[model samples]
Target: MKGQSYSSISFATPSPKQYSETMLHAQQNHATNALRSESKIIPACLPTPNPSSPNFASRFRTDIVQLVETSNIHKHSDTCYKYWNANRGDKKTCRMRMPRKLVSNSTIDPATGDICMRRSDPWINNFNDYLITACRSNMDIKFIWSGSDAKALVYYITDYVTKT
Candidate 1:
């Protein structure tokens, strides 16, 4: 009942329909691909460029892909398995969960009211194309559908803000 009015952005790679829609818009607008430097690296900070330009949609798609590739892909490190304990029979797992389980389609469970956003790539963190493009940085977003989720989010924010 609490989450009924709230909408969520989809997860993982954009669906083929989304990609095709972008392509169609680009074609309709006669947008041409802009040239880029040989280096694939994007600057850490970027100015918010004009979104009204004729090539905005096409350029936006390109920028989103580049930004995600450069920063959003997860790679496991020593810290990932920091909690593992063989003696105690604790299973090896990443504290910051990486390689999330793939969901082929976005769905809301009828009985439980759980939302599963569509996901394709396992190694990529959750991101919104528009948010990542505007901030020019990596981002992680999740829907707070239940009381437990809201509590966890509040705790996380409080802990982060109170940290020295």
Candidate 2:
């Protein structure tokens, strides 16, 4: 993980691929800050320009997060957003954000155990290269599997996206 990049988008859930050993250390440090354990969103010392900052590219796209949060839920299904494969028989699914009561929803295939995400889904991946030319940015936030922060993750997520 020495040369690898990390997400600066606050409330971002570091995808395992992008975050390997560095997060392991960060996870260990969570005991120091109990909130980190609950949210799995640590206050990393990553130094970079943030998209939410004033310098963010005004031309950069913001519709991806919009489609997920505000668009018609029915129309924003995995298929509509192109985040899932209807042809796949197992057809497991999950969401970056879900209704508070619908906590058990998984954007993964139960049978296949594969993450049901589309490579094309902008909101589902790190935006480092695509969104910023210099800053290492990652907007694709993974969900916290458990902890007290689970209840408040949606609120934090809104902040993360809107800041972008």
Candidate 3:
């Protein structure tokens, strides 16, 4: 889907307190080592910077960039083309729909009321800056804008919960 922007997308930014608490909790739980071992993205366990610190903005941005580069960048695998069917003339496509179209800016569609969030990178999964920084893990965040979207999310959650 070249040049196709997402129909509805939004990112919720966590409050400073929320961010700080989450980061503090993560540090207290010793999740840094686990994150390092799992992704090796972080070179060392860095203390969570205070919001008011002079270097907090730079440090936070650096951490988010590193985490996103390590975990949010999408790479194609066999599963990406599992539904490909040359016989049916179906072009190979990733089920998770990686390599999404890049959006220049966030806007709401006048006719459809769909929100298209700005996306500069086509291969990076949707993420929230605060979430990835606080959780230090891969995450996908999207806004539910329509009834269909809400229904689909509910079904997916239910299916996952009921899975044997």
Candidate 4:
């Protein structure tokens, strides 16, 4: 049995009917209510800026990093990969370049290290609009959904309104 040739062993492939049924089930699963939930929230993807605003970029990137770092996403590494790629083209190139972190103007509770904001106000939408406008005017924008429903909406609202 040691170093024996086993090339003659036959493999049993699934029959065509079985394969077709599996494919159909997969397709059905792909088109389910859970999958459809993601579509309910609008994608807030915007363009990367042209002649980028250093201030805006710094603030946005820092805020986004903080958000991602703090988020409860299960696969944090994969989320970071998607986010970094969407913002900075590729991981290697971005890592090579120096990044600017945005300063927050919000009152940070020394006790909690949390940047607090009121979630009850209409200004959230305004902030989202501002970010969308800034991205459109300044750079080529790309937004990859974080696989969490409402993440895009939350990012736009929080990043712009609570600008530090």
**Which candidate tops TM-score?**
1
Report the alpha-carbon TM-score of model 4 versus the true structure: 0.16
Q: lDDT by residue for model 3 over 2-96, one digit each (tens)? A: 23232232353333443465455445435444765687546324445467865455445446555766787889998888889989999888888
Q: Cα miss at 7, model 4 (Å)?
A: 71
Which digits, one per residue and each the tens of the lDDT, describe model 4 over residues 88-162?
A: 555442331223232233244666444432222211111232343334222212233333425657887899999
Better of 2 and 4 by lDDT: 2
TM-score of 2: 0.22
Model 3, position 33, has a per-residue lDDT of 42
lDDT of 2 by residue, 26-127 (tens): 444443336534665523322333567542332122222222222212223655435666676545545544321321222665664444322332333323
Local accuracy by lDDT, each model: 0.67, 0.37, 0.65, 0.33
Clashes of 4: 12
> Model 2, residue 26: displacement in angstroms?
2.4
Candidates, ranked, lDDT? 1, 3, 2, 4
In candidate 4, stretches whose alpha carbon ends up further than 4 angstroms from where it belongs are 1-105, 118-120, 126-130, 136-164
Clash pairs, model 1 backbone: none
Instruction: Quote each prediction's TM-score.
Output: 0.72, 0.22, 0.67, 0.16
Model 1 lDDT on a 0 to 1 scale: 0.67
Whichever of 2 and 3 has more TM-score, that candidate is 3
Kindly list the per-residue Cα lDDT of model 1 for residues 15-82, writing each as its tens digit. 55555665565444432322234332363344444678655556566556667767888889999888
Q: Candidate 1: where is the Cα deviation over 4 Å?
A: 1-11, 16-36, 39-43, 46-49, 162-164
**Model 2 misplaced regions, further than 4 Å:** 1-18, 31-33, 38-123, 129-164
* Order of the predicted models by TM-score, top scorer first: 1, 3, 2, 4
